[model samples]
Target: MEQKIEKLSTVKIQKSPDVYKVVDALNRTLKEDDLMFGLALDEDKEKMVFTIYRT
Candidate 1:
């Protein structure tokens, strides 16, 4: 069976951003392997869904 992942929180950031900076910030705020995260962006042809996954 698949396990259910609980959402601790939801946050919004700028689309098509420098992901390294975001990860660095998250790493500082959250402990290693203690959280799950995702990013959202516009799905238009000229836009990109630049996301960085962490846990």
Candidate 2:
């Protein structure tokens, strides 16, 4: 179960309540493709940072 995750791209998005849902869905749907999604909060600007990774 050793995997190397590499950051592909990242973008700042407007905060959304369903962000977690989106990330979960992506992880489930794309796991077979070696793709992972992550979400981070930028509290200072009240924004969501979405990052894509390849394993």
Candidate 3:
């Protein structure tokens, strides 16, 4: 299956072990509002990239 998502915003944040907890919470809390959250590592593999999408 193929799906396309729209990018709303992207931010660089300090890498933290518990960052995913926040992302998961956001997804569970606001999914009904058509918003999605994602977390990933930057190219340097030091900082984390947070992205919000409109689904």
On TM-score, the leading prediction is: 3
- Per-candidate Cα RMSD to the true structure, in Å, reads 4.9, 1.6, 1.6
Candidate 2, run of 10 with poorest lDDT: 40-49
User: Clashing residue pairs, candidate 2?
Assistant: none
Tens-digit per-residue lDDT, 1-55, candidate 3: 8767899999999999999999999999999999999999999999999999998
The alpha-carbon deviation from the true structure for residue 31 of candidate 2, after best TM-score superposition, in angstroms, is 0.4
> Comparing 2 and 3 by lDDT, which wins?
3
TM-scores of the candidates are 0.40, 0.87, 0.90
lDDT of 1 by residue, 1-55 (tens): 8755566665444554576477667756764666544555555534434344444
Better candidate by lDDT, 1 or 3: 3
Candidates' C-alpha lDDT = 0.54, 0.94, 0.96
Off by over 4 Å in 2: 43-45
TM-score of 1: 0.40
Candidate 3 backbone clash number: 0
Better of 2 and 3 by TM-score: 3
Give the CA lDDT, 0 to 100, for residue 52 in model 3. Answer: 100
Winner on lDDT between 1 and 2 is 2
